[model samples]
Target: MTSLSVLNSALLVLSVALVLLHVSATRAKPNKARTLFAIFCGSIAFLMCKQLSAASIGPYQFLIGIGASATCNAYWLFSRVFFRRRDAIKPQHLYVAVAIALLVAMNQIYMFLKGMAVFTPAPDALVRYILVELTLLLSSCILVLTFWEGCRGFGKDTFEGKAQRILFLSVFVFALAGSKIAKGLLADNPQALEYIISAITLLVMVSTQILLMWRYTNHLDFLTTIPLRERLQPSAATDATKATDSRGELSPLARQIRDLIIGQAQYLQENLKVSDIARELDAPEYLISKAIRTELGAANFNQYVNTLRIAHAQTLLADPDHLKTSILAIGLDSGFASVGPFTRAFKTKTGLTPSEYRQNLQAK
Candidate 1:
């Protein structure tokens, strides 16, 4: 086998190994993120196998080609599941992915038939051109959407979460997109140059896998999702207390955070951010985040802040004096940017809508 083939084979093995690792981890933790990540890894393996079988024509090659065509879709779905705080992969997501895969597969089959002289058409045939262009257009759109997903709510993410997002966008998204564009531009280049490009792309993939493994082992929270309520429950509080002392006193930094947000009511400031609190306290953002996680039993800075905001809103919602106050007014006074997120966060925390909570309070 040629050197490019050998490298492709090695990458295929590594990609399959990653799939197995994610699968095993999912079995242990029952995480949707890990399962979707495993699917993404499986798609990468299929792409490598498709490249390895480029010279062969058979049913296996056709199936590999179809799987390879779904790589962008798989990555997009994985990104949505991983980075979006509340979004999950719905049935429509799968339907769209499958539809795109079928379109790309049909385009590939058309090209294969034309190459075999089974059908002849003009080089500029409208039908063939449209199919090819549509395939590329959809793939490009999906890649852009994936990048957007990684960037959504970036400012609110913890420091480690931000780093993981940057790593994924840089290594996986940019590398793969750049390689595809370069391959198209250099289609007529020397075979050796193509092999060199392939080698670099595979090396980037290896780097991505290594970084992901490191993050998985050392910072698993960045890769997994835990419910906000679970993070804030009494059990988590007990664990945090145990980490500190028998007295269950808050750490010094945690005390300062509480003093500012609770005592000073800084959470009443709209668009409150960890960086703003860090600046106020003259501390680093990561340190502030760590204090909240370890001492306050919050999943992140936003959750901690939202918990405070919701609690404050609950007081207003339960007060007969504030009965004249609209829910929007109360949400604004409680520091929410708008009523939508305020309502959502309130519901997640209190298990009732703001209106429902108020109605229940009045009924009591």
Candidate 2:
């Protein structure tokens, strides 16, 4: 039989490798979330080393400079970076990340100092239990905050899809936490039971990593070039369901919205609003919402606008007549605030830098 400690060590090692694999794959020009995720993975690896060692044959309850709060914050920050738009990852986000992790680190450091200063003869068991509970509460609160924002920001009207996924995660997390609490109630049981619980924790962590990767690839990373309307509306559906109004052959409302934005260059406005569009068209807010999101199949308004900007930039880059135009100028002309975001967005859509794209056009 495999020893629990050895199993934990193996699992932790596997998880570390997976995290490192993702970081390496995206490192050429690492995204903001990718960098933050790397830091989180590194911290978790260090903690796992200490915990696995203590369980198997190392020091007793040694501190590893990271704890529950740090891991929880890492999870939250990863979600933020992964879902937010390319330009959304700003300096303030870095400050916020540092602030959250620093708060937990400071508390731990202060407690460690206090312990050294007031070495009591007898260890306070109740105090330790209370501290554990507080840590769990803090971590749970952070998870709540992360989940709310993460699902909200995911494109494609994700309130139903992504939010449901987060709900599933919440159930899994609480169920695991409950199991631990139940195990603690079995204090009179054999010492080996503790090892079993640790093994379960290791399994849970591995499963979480797998779920995250699967979700990222399956839904978030799965790009589609087809028109959004076709994906949702099956070919076998009746023609009557197509709702052919004056909007156009595709979707009259959707086409109207697109034409107004494209022809008038409304996308050039950085702070465009759904309400504003609705008011201009004298349509109800939900009607316009349905036009863009349900009928058009855009992830959200921002994504729809980004598509226009990226497509426009592509045209400018590929135009032989505009051979002397600077990439930065094209990016700005296409509604991007700066060259960095413009480049990232362009690469994301076309899988090439503006220069490379231009060169390819010339070659063809």
Which candidate tops TM-score? 1
Which stretches of model 1 miss by more than 4 angstroms? 1-26, 56-60, 112-118, 121-125, 172-181, 184-190, 196-217, 220-364
Report the error of model 2 at residue 42, Å: 2.3
> At residue 316, what lDDT does model 2 achieve?
66
Off by over 4 Å in 2: 1-29, 55-63, 67-69, 83-100, 103-137, 150-364
Worst 10 residues of 2 by lDDT: 223-232
The C-alpha local distance difference test score for the whole of candidate 1 amounts to: 0.67
- For 1-364, candidate 2 gives per-residue lDDT tens digits of 4466655554656476456646534643333345555555666565555555555442322445545334667657766654443244457655655666666655555455554655442475566556556666767776676666545633332223355456545745664575667578767753455455545545545554554454443332232233322322235222322433222445556655764455334565555678767765678878777776665546577777777777667656766656888888778767778899888977866677888889988988
Q: Judge candidate 1 at residue 142 and give its lDDT.
A: 87
lDDT of 1 by residue, 168-280 (tens): 77776567666777778777764644565556546644554554454444443321133333433434344543444433666677877865565434666788789888876
TM-score of each: 0.54, 0.45
